[model samples]
Target: MSDLRTELSTNLDEAAWEWLIPHVQRDAVIVVASDLDLLDVGVAIASDNISSVQQWIDQQLMVKPSNTQVGNWNSDRTKKFHTLILQPYVLVQEMAA
Candidate 1:
């Protein structure tokens, strides 16, 4: 719905890697690919678009940060990401420099 989309868009935020560490620790973070729009993904998830969500996951376009990635981000606290929290999950896409 447009209302949901607008709401999600407003909730989108830029967060430093350090700020996101807690979510990562809770295993609540899902990474969206840079090529995709974070809002679109958030809408799909919030609306229960299972097919599309599963398709992205099957393609590895959406995934939780791996230990190596977590480590890298941890080492560089300055890294930033676009984030949208959809309860139980924090959708993240690394911001393009």
Candidate 2:
């Protein structure tokens, strides 16, 4: 396995760090894909500071409801309510190297 390191500097709280760290570490590719009009906004928000990203994520998660049910309703309903958003950052180093 390849080990990747990403450092995020933001004003986000410790809780946000707990949530985001694992996702960033597991992601193989980070893609910034959004509409042109939203590009500037996205980049600006993403680059502003770590706190900004954390706040955005927290807000998104707040509005979204989690689906823990398992059954026929699990797949379809779960997909409709899920959201994963993040800013793309360059891979700075590989610890396994």
Candidate 3:
């Protein structure tokens, strides 16, 4: 695996990360969320340059046709967010506890 894949795999579950690695950019930020009911999952990929990320979402993930230009105030002023919905799972935790 490449360095980016290795780093992301540490942050994400193995199966999910493997599926996502090919579509994610080297410097993008990945956020994985599972709902309280544990029946839904959401993944967001953010980056300053999001063309590749947007392409993946359009072609592979098949998000509904709409504006992709949703902005974020809490994140870096220059970057943006792309999201995907999926099944439930935990994303982050203390790795060596």
Candidate 4:
């Protein structure tokens, strides 16, 4: 767990920490995912509610094109939604002051 904590601390940015600081509970495992396709496992989002995440995945997976463009961005830029998997790692939130 120390190794994961160290890794998260080293990798996570201020904004990421800000989001988790309030929601995560110290000594508890937290699953996290992103659109960058980590560990060759695609992308995922961390949340305590697995059912809701699964439902979101189910609804999003139904898209035929897979990738969709939303909002303003470069013409070549596109976004692809990925699946959410239960991560094996656990995250223990740091205590707030």
Clashes of each: 0, 5, 0, 3
Superior by TM-score: candidate 2 or candidate 4 = 2
- Per-residue accuracy of model 2 over 1-97 as CA lDDT, tens digit each: 0111122222211222223334445652122222222233234454565675465455542122223322323344322211124344321111111
State the C-alpha lDDT per candidate: 0.93, 0.30, 0.30, 0.31
TM-score of each: 0.96, 0.22, 0.25, 0.22
Ranking by TM-score: 1, 3, 2, 4
Supply the global lDDT for candidate 3: 0.30
- lDDT of candidate 1 over 1-97, digit per residue (tens): 9999999888899999988999999999999999988999999999999999999999999998999999888888899999998889999998765
Please report the TM-score between candidate 1 and the true structure.
Answer: 0.96
For model 1, the stretches where C-alpha displacement exceeds 4 angstroms are none
Question: After superposition, which runs of candidate 4 have C-alpha atoms over 4 Å from their true positions?
Answer: 1-45, 61-72, 76-97
lDDT of 4 at 90: 32
Per-residue lDDT of model 3, residues 1-97, tens digit only:
2453344444433332334333333323234222211112122332223664465445543232222311222222333223332323232211111
lDDT of 2 at 40: 33
The local lDDT score (0 to 100) that residue 96 gets in candidate 3 is 18
Local accuracy of candidate 4 as per-residue lDDT tens digits, 12-59 = 322233333233234222322333233222222332446654654565
Q: Which one is best on lDDT?
A: 1
How good is model 2 by TM-score? 0.22
